[model samples]
Target: FFFSAFHCRGIRDDIEEEDEQVSDAINVSGAAPPKLCTSFAHFGFDEQLMHQIRKSEYTQPTPIQCQGVPIALSGRDMIGIAKTGSGKTAAFIWPMLVHIMDQKELEPGEGPIAVIVCPTRELCQQIHAECKRFGKAYSLRSVAVYGGGSMWEQAKALQEGAEIVVCTPGRLIDHVKKKATSLQRVTYLVFDEADRMFDMGFEYQVRSIASHVRPDRQTLLFSATFRKKIERLARDILVDPIRVVQGDIGEANEDVTQVVEILLSGSDKWAWLTRRLVEFTSAGSVLIFVTKKANSDELAANLTQEGYSLGLLHGDMDQSERNKVISDFKKKNLPILVATDVAARGLDIPSIRTVVNYDVARDIDTHTHRIGRTGRAGEKGVAYTLLTHKDTTFAGDLVRNLEGANQAVSKELMDLAMQNPWFRKSRFKGGKGKRLNIGGGGLGYKERPGLGAESSVSYQTLFLENCIISSIFLKSERKTCMMLSHCRIVASAAVCLQPVALKVTANQPPELWGIACLH
Candidate 1:
């Protein structure tokens, strides 16, 4: 029934998929899979634009581009899912540019013909800069609208005319409400990092701005992860959109190595992290994410005092200050940056060798993006972390993410997993017991009397960016969203580990779980 609404006239004979095994995640109903292009020329890009593509050093289409560009160029609405740093921006850019070029020439000081909305200021500028590269080849006007810059300049740029407007939702909403920008002529709408925009509490603003756009416009939604909100939104607006999932919906990127260390107390964190910083200082550029704005300060100071170069970034900093920090860090003048979650999702820098979680992230999505800051564009990178008692409460999600990243799981983590029925069930599903149920709804595991309520990890809470083992998300009227903080178990619980034939009895004691051994 769903497939009947989609038209199949967009398939081109020139493009050919490279005999790739399609992921089971992609669901196109009856439509044949969109043929992936072997090269950019297969899509019939203009010679001048192709010149710009090469001058920009793009040799060929990336995976997301290979799959997404063809469908997009076919003039069909699309929902593309790929991990961060996967060249997603270009995937959508090529098609949007082609479509714009096909139409009558846009005049300066005229309403934009296309709108590309994203979640952050950094990403907005990045997309706009990229658009200009291709748009300029055809003499198309492109501008970025975001907060923290001169509103007068942005308003003037919009008034003077631009065919492409890459903007953040909040500022764009302000512009639309103020009558400074017009979207009446917009025929192309893109929600880049759609999941992150919703995650950041921009749903209402996005929907409101989207309401102002013409319904006949072609829409494209791209995201790294898909939550229920994203799925629901897609259903409401996208008309039989072609779903192009480049990778598993929530699968972790394989380019980064995840490392975890057990920290017994707050006293140990500074000393432990400082030693790592000293050793890693010369290795490459680094980004350290702390949970609180205040935490960024203390970590930055300690690192500087320890003779390591570092910069700080947080929500409280002024725009100019933040820009300077990011600029210095990217310039390699500041090799290390201590930041809060504000910098987690968007800000892409070059050659960031490692991402340090000085403070444990609030959720699995946060964790996924934090690690994504490094290991971009297929470069090898590392995500180092200090796991404390407060954080071990999420041992299930943490362990699965580590294992998914192909890191060596320590015995301590394995023991923590042993105590978690959710972890045992998911982490060893194929090898161990079938799904177990206790009472009416719980897992068949005895809860330690000291741990309070009995619970199991909500399998439904697992996101496609499959780093998280399990989670339970709750909606809030005021806060937008919050994940359940209640944990299944704690350290005092008894555990026994049987790593293959290397089995250890419960009599060996839980404290011994921390001892090092060959995995």
Candidate 2:
């Protein structure tokens, strides 16, 4: 079906009947598991907690909360994978409160019972807010520690000893080193947005923090994306964990209508954006995403000079100023926000009606997160992307994702995807008397007449070099050999194939370089 945003002046209010039926099926895989809790009452939570759930107006549990909360309550490690804005925060927060409340009270000079570490400062605060929202039911204490805020104030909060501590990696390590907080007493540890944390180069800090926690403690990791590094990290820390996958990993939310428009160049983006800003912002709050921090400032300045008041958010701003900007945006004080990727990951605002990619995302995963900022909690939302030729590397992936969601793909977008080398089909056109056959093993070349063993070997080497250069986009190792003995391209058979060897060093694009030889 066509995305309605393209047909109207603003975000289309006419959502299709089929678009409303977003899939809620979840796949839970592991050893023996507890019965799935379809509703909050199934968990047999405390009466006050039940009242809080009702007061919050949560009618039913999200897919992740249905399966993941019970697993966490079973005292087993878990890796919760779901799309962003899928209520993943509440999935772990509810269980963590139960785990903390069942334990003894914190004593003087002691640490929190639960430690939740995420990648960004904004996410750290977001999780802390969630912790407070639910923890208030049990009169539980929670504190948020992150960078750019007052370190001494955070240290004071730590020294006072809260039952739950939400923080980012760097500041938490600093607190640990200063003896402001101790992880030895922590029995419940969480790595929210686990993939992003590791992606941002927090592996060493995360591993170090995990080492300080009690070995027998319960660990949990929650993220919208899962990667090889996260899998390896889970294996090292978790003890027989259950994997709760809410939906297909790396796929955009079905509730979001993605519209991609191909632009001639970067210079055309500003004009395209200016024409749509009035209609988009008039409908509801709009978030404009840029690739760099400097770009966020520049765009915000340009917009303000045009008499449009908007909020600006990036990592460079101090914590207080950033907090104020986000507060104003959340209260609907500002109708528009220009932000960098820092706001792309875990900062959730349900009122955001549309997200605009002024600068195309650097990678497929980033693109997924950028669109995820809208269409939260099954609310219909729209995302517009401005694409140029320089972003062709990820165009193929973007097109595939759109098609997977059953959204309409434009001809211009399909043409760009076809032009990408990684997705392009290879055609072999070579000299006569040489037959090329590709099989499960590798490429094979049959022999031709009037070619000696030595010359055949040289031709094979040249062919192998061509293969390496052609498939340089692949990251994995390829072991292949060619056995061709023909040349219509070269006039003289004597000098047709030369015995030249090439070796790609470690700095090359592909991680592994293959050494080819004659069979």
Candidate 3:
């Protein structure tokens, strides 16, 4: 079920303008002292630290950074629940870097001071990159350790004495067990995307790694959602830490427009999907969500065979393969990526314009995370769900849960379900099936051989031109719809050749003259 409350415009401009005015009024009258840099500046950070921030082009601090940075700098534990892409990485990294830089020099055999554990290798690499960028001016050293790569290289980096280590739980634990790296002297420990790690069944590994770290170290936990499990885990790890909750859990971004299309089992989901792709032709990139890894793989294969530039990612894939797929997808070399839940967590891609749930998720939490992939960083995004009869109950449960969270389902979506057929057998069991016979042509559009007298509007012929244009311009949505709409308008216009002029009069909205002429 699509929810109206899930659609939000984010930080209303009017409210922001009002706040700016109020702030100016207060400042002009000298009613309050300017907010001092009581946070980082008070911590005795060197000039190099400030210079690094300036070089990184960071103009202002996010709320997490503003509050959590100081506390973490003070060597206190912290638990933060902020929305994805809220600059949480920097919040933890900056203070950690400051501490490392202030140490001036380490003993000949002193180990790393901080160890940052992320759920995915991608996130581990991302965190490592950000740390390096921020620590560049201070000449601080950092290394990323994750599976799917040569351990030799990572060990070499570790042997060189990195002050900070960003790693995935499993790989880091491997190193710890081998005594290749030691966290005995580490002063700070961070669990980034804590919920995802638990969901991915990394609890044991994370706990094992944590046990190796000093118990007296400051522990920081950051996640988008804080369920009972996450809260309990935080309690076990953090010591009387400050809690900062910036957004509601499982809340969809307001800037995303969500729609649900109910379809019968026999209905061609591919056709419906093709139509939606056309509608969102101008969107930068699209992520299609499927239930199983096999389905994601098959879908990507079929789409690619149909001439669509596509990529596939799933847990079963090797780390190197997954990294390549993600890299290609992010660079827009592959416009579409079929993926499972693994890609849904802590993967920040700002250019994703749309998300399509080819199959409804089994649970509300999964649904929330899938759609949350788009509509990031204050950008407008769209999400569509292709629903079938078998998914009704699951969809209903999801809507009910959202309602409980103050998000109401859209009545329009519920009504839309009635028009679609619901009970057709799935083409594939567990989403494993042969690729459909989508003929190859320019821009994923194949021309059919036969044309009849009554075949006035051939989707193949009409869409061929549109597809070429769309592919060249990256307009998948427009390609899907332009042909159909053009055919309808052309047929109607052929019936009457009268000069019909649409006009917008002084005070009236524009009126369509063709409809009157049709009558």
Candidate 4:
């Protein structure tokens, strides 16, 4: 199974037959949940290791870590389902360190004891850095190997006896094929962002790499979304793993405020983006997502010409350029970077305060992943997406997703949705007559009623100077009748054949004080 740009899809439809086809859930009991983690002391971590964790500013264990760390330490396989940026990396990292450090030092030609596989080079680097910190405390060396990196440097690092190896599937397969590195002693295996790996069509390579590892190794799979497809992959790899499910699957980050702007035309998209950069974003780093690799560079060039500081990250660039752009982004020097879907999956940039979908993603999953780039590590973020007529196919899903995330959907966007047949059929009923948009702009009425000439009344009010009338048949020089606002009705039976304007009286009728006015 391989992914191609033409299809813009994930894995092949055919699910490869597995050696064992057990698809049922397997539960393992480990440490109970703690409402809050005061310190790492209660998790059975060494005093030296605890110092590193504390120095890293992880004062308390996040929910995933609180339960996941203990289970991983128990030497049980784990399938952790948590939202992105929920500290899942640290969850497996902490316990994997404990296991690796307990083992004796590796010989000069020996293999790594722990192997962590991620979908992209950026993620591999991130996980590798974390492992290095904890491993360094106990003199356990770790190395990161991924495609686009120097093969010689990676092979030499492996030869030096790294206790832990964090790498992507394709690069790992290359090293294994060349006998540059071996997974013979790998006791702890982690698949971070497992769904993304499968999405990129790395199943064959992942399984091929797995063949080199010991069968008794403890495997762990962590995914932001626990979809049925992800579950199938988990069944294939894990052995009766402990299932730790927390948070809504594929839900947008709570700290992110999502927005969808339906444009009248494609040309308006750039104008909207420029306006947003100048007005929508205020103080934080911004990430702009484009639909294609070319758009990334084009948008970056245009924005840069406009005096905004930005860089580009896409698959078309050489690994060196991508790394430099990522480095610049991390350093906050290039606060705004235009990127393609290649930058979507788990690239952590904690200071990103906003994400702009210069081109709205093709699917809701893609949109969620793009928006996830911001609001990472519990920081607040806002995402602005520009939508056009071409993306009508996804309008229904986009609206529901925004509403599901508790974000406001614009009335104009909903009005545009009525034209979409899918939205009209499936989403019309429950959503009808519900217009929450108040002052931003909109007539505010949910439905538009057609009126014939005889049934219609024209409103012509020049002034209301101390004059009160529940029912008014005002006659101007040109217009004949006046209609009440919000469908207020008139009780008078007689029609005003000859309309007359009312004059203001200084004093209100005494009886009016007791009666509430309707008009």
Q: How close is candidate 2 to the true structure, as a TM-score?
A: 0.77
Model 1 C-alpha lDDT per residue in residues 1-519, reported as the tens digit of each score: 432312322221111123232222232321323344446655556677889999988876677776677567655567887767778888888778866765555555457878999987777877888998888788888989988878888888888888899999999878777778788778789998887898789999888877787665678988876666887777666655666654445545678888877778878988887767766767889899999977888878877777887889988887789888888998999989999988887678866998888888887667878888888877888888777765645666666556544467789776765676766765476532111210012112122223224221111111122121112111121111111111121111101111011112213443332322222
Model 3 misplacement above 4 A: 1-57, 400-408, 412-519
Residue pairs with colliding backbones in model 4 are none
Q: Relative to the true structure, how large is the alpha-carbon lDDT of every model?
A: 0.66, 0.72, 0.61, 0.66
Candidate 4 achieves a global lDDT of 0.66
| TM-score, every prediction | 0.76, 0.77, 0.69, 0.74
- Among these predictions, the greatest lDDT belongs to 2
Q: How displaced is residue 3 in candidate 1, in Å?
A: 40
How would the candidate models be sorted by TM-score, starting from the highest?
Answer: 2, 1, 4, 3
Model 4 per-residue lDDT at 304: 84
Candidate 1: segments with Cα more than 4 A from true spot: 1-17, 21-33, 107-109, 406-408, 421-519
**Stretches of candidate 2 above 4 Å error?**
1-24, 426-519
